[model samples]
Target: MSPMILIALILQICVTNVITGEYSEVVHNFKSIRKNVALSILVIDGDESNIDSSSLSSAEFVKVPNIEDLYIINILNSLDKNIFTSLHRLQHLKIEENELSYIGPAVWAGLDLEKLSLRNNQIEKLDNRAFDGLKASMIDLSNNKLRTLPNKCLQSLRLYKLTLANNQLEDIDLETFGPELAYADLSNNLLTSLDVEVFSGVYALLNLNLSGNKLTSIVAAPTLKKLKVLNYSHNQISVIAGNAFDSYNQLMELYLDHNQIFRLNHQSFPSIAPIKKFTIDHNYLTGLSDELLNALDNLAYLKFGGNPWSCKCLERVLEFIRSNKIGTDYCESKLIPQGHSCVNYYDKCYGNETKILSQNFEIYKNFIKHYEC
Candidate 1:
């Protein structure tokens, strides 16, 4: 054999050996990355990766199929399911945007969690003891297909924000929430009515939203001292009790829009001096008495459009508009065209043409300075 041919053969063998050993070395390094993992929380934001972390092998993690949010639908369980329990330090878990319908209890057997978020999924039912040892700060089951929330599913959450919005919930016992709750959103559900005692023990509550439900009336707590914002929109409410807002001294905003309310009497609100905004639009109101709104002395915004106004009693409101009390252009909105004067009294045309009802619009000068309308 020639000397040049012998050198060429040796070079070819060296190149082949390097190519064969590259893939095996890469796999070995991947196994070392997931060794002895220990942590309380984990956020897995993608799929198709060999994670062999030693320090986080036992942690709880909020795992998604991929950070791109396209892995689960792209491949049918391409990743191994055993990766969920590889984290030893994981206590709180939040898995979102995955193709998960139901989670087995054994998948999270020895975790210590105080928060969990399973939003934007298709979970229909939660099993008993599925959340047995959780001490979470909050849990979000919103935007799911849940028909009923098992009382036990929330028992372990000693105190936290619980959101169950945009679901198929038809019934919920008020007492199902834990004592440490500071906020709750049960809106956009099939709930017909809420239990009054549901808020009895929650002292830290600051905001509550029950809008877009089937409630015919509101039955709020009598001692919700920390309450701030209460939204009860898009319901069948026709009646409002006078003492409904008695205990909420710190209340700020109240929404009662899109209901069947035709009247509000004196003492309907509990004289909340701290309240700044109140909305009562989209209803069947024909007239408003002064006594009904006298208690909201600090009111800044009062939305009252989208209702049939009686021209007879509207002289007071028209005069207020002309005097710029509420500062809103409601009278000029084309819904009431004859300008502010006709709506002030033009409806009493035929027999009572000369009779002008006594309405004092002068006192509203003080109200105009406070409210821009």
Candidate 2:
């Protein structure tokens, strides 16, 4: 047989022996394997107590010249700096459910990694150059104890999907991430407010989630022009600047539910593309004016329930809802009933009385045309 075929046969036999548990010691197994064959995939998972760190260190996997994918799960020890030093061709690496608390610089210095996931770990800190040599396109560091991102940690990476959810991040610098990033999820954090410069260089971003935060206002920013979907729900937002979404012509879906917004600026949605889904339910809104209704001409779906609708303003909103066929039961259903009753100036028109008046738009329109708020 030729040398290449002979080497392949020997490597196959060694792998079979390793899988059948013939080798009693890990170091012996590593030493017995054919070193000429490249190790393309390696997965090590088990209880940390059973693994011998000395044997792992002696295995010399770094000697393999073409290791590509590596997954190490439930390992109790911190990541060894030498594990990936010689893996110049490594592409995907996942290390989950570990006891790792910190990642120092030069841990991944020599690999051309593409996808890296360190999810579900106790990682609390990252050095500035921890990700220095990696060219990862997708990085998921979710479900960790990270309180902050290190400066220049993500400065030069060409990332497409980055998820930092379920952390304690209170703020992030605009220049920390490169401009080519497309999808980012910063939800379930401790963010109190986001400045307009937070999205300054991210022009290709398509989806952004900022829910479950403590934000109070929705400020206008010009860098979110290409965003298609936004989730700003579950926040303490009470004010939205008129130009908050001025140049965001590509936004299609928006979620503003469960906020403290009592009013909206008339030009809040000036000159944007047709919105497919828009929800403002469960807020403190009291009325919707004609100017706001006209600006939402391209709105195809809406959720306006759970607001204290004034009787006079409720009639006009109901007329807009009826005219646009907003709901399946628009004409027959009571638009503002129970939780959405007339309050303050129109206190007498409450409960079923507001409901009955809202069901008839033509008469309600003529009745309200001469009426005053």
Best by TM-score: 2
Candidate 1 residue lDDT tens string, 132-251: 544457778898888887764675557568899999899886567776778889999999977888777778888889999989888758757888999998987877887777788898
In candidate 1, stretches whose alpha carbon ends up further than 4 angstroms from where it belongs are 1-92, 103-115, 312-373
Task: Please provide TM-scores, in order, for all candidate models, with all chains considered together.
Answer: 0.66, 0.73
Among all candidates shown, the one with the greatest lDDT? 2
Q: Give the TM-score of candidate 1.
A: 0.66
lDDT of 2 by residue, 1-373 (tens): 9999999999999889757544312222334434533466665665534554222342465555565776767753466554577667778888777777788776776666778889888888988888887778889898888888887688688788898988888888666777888888888888998878777777888888888888887756688788898889999887788778886788888889778776676677855556667877666665777877887787777776655556567677767766886652232245533355435324342445445434533333442354332
| Global lDDT of each candidate | 0.59, 0.70
